[model samples]
Target: MKKLIETIVKPLVDHPDDVRIGVEERQGRLVCSLSVHPEDMGKVIGKQGRVASAIRTVVNSAEGAGRKRVRVDIMD
Candidate 1:
């Protein structure tokens, strides 16, 4: 799960090395915290948050079997 987020976000960022993801299990839900370079924050989030939404959708679809709720937080 972490790798999937990394793979999708890393390439789009100007600083791939700065892309970091942290996963935490809270109340049976998975929360993914994505940290990217300041310069690439807008890119990962996209206009009106479309990119963030897409990433969450992919995570949700991929975790269908487990029915785990996934949330993505784009952090500066």
Candidate 2:
């Protein structure tokens, strides 16, 4: 799951090396937090949060067959 998000996002940012992904299990839900370099934040989020929304959608779909709820948080 982490790799899928990274593969989708890393190429779109200027600071690929700065991309960080952390997964935490909370209350049976899976929270995926993605942090990127300040300069690349805008690209990851896109205009009006479209990029962020897309990322979350993919993550949720990838959770297939698992009951855990998936979330994506783009951190500065």
Candidate 3:
């Protein structure tokens, strides 16, 4: 899951090396935290948050992720 998020986000950021994703299980839910260089935040978020929303949708649709609650958080 971590790799999946990283792969998806990295390409959208100016600083691919700065893209980071942390996964933690909380109350039976999978929480993914994504961090990128400040300058790339807008690129990751896109217009009207469409990019972020799409990212979350893709993550949530992944195999096992569909059966569990997966949350994606884009952090600065």
CA RMSD of all predictions: 1.0, 1.0, 1.4
Best-to-worst TM-score order: 2, 1, 3
Kindly list the per-residue Cα lDDT of model 3 for residues 38-59, writing each as its tens digit.
9999999999999999999898
Error of 1 at 11 (Å): 1.2
Q: What is the C-alpha lDDT of each candidate?
A: 0.90, 0.91, 0.88
What is candidate 2's local distance difference test score?
0.91
Task: Kindly list the per-residue Cα lDDT of model 1 for residues 1-76, writing each as its tens digit.
Answer: 8999998998888899999899999999999999998999899999999999999899888888758898888887
lDDT by residue (32-58, candidate 2, tens digit) is 899999999999999999999999988
Clashes of 3: 0
Candidate 2's TM-score reads 0.94
Q: What is the Cα-based lDDT of residue 24 in candidate 3?
A: 90
> In terms of TM-score, how similar is model 3 to the real structure?
0.92
TM-scores of the models, in the given order?
0.93, 0.94, 0.92
The better-scoring model by lDDT among 1 and 2 is: 2
Q: Name the lDDT of candidate 3.
A: 0.88
- Model 1's alpha-carbon lDDT is 0.90
Worst 10 residues of 3 by lDDT: 59-68
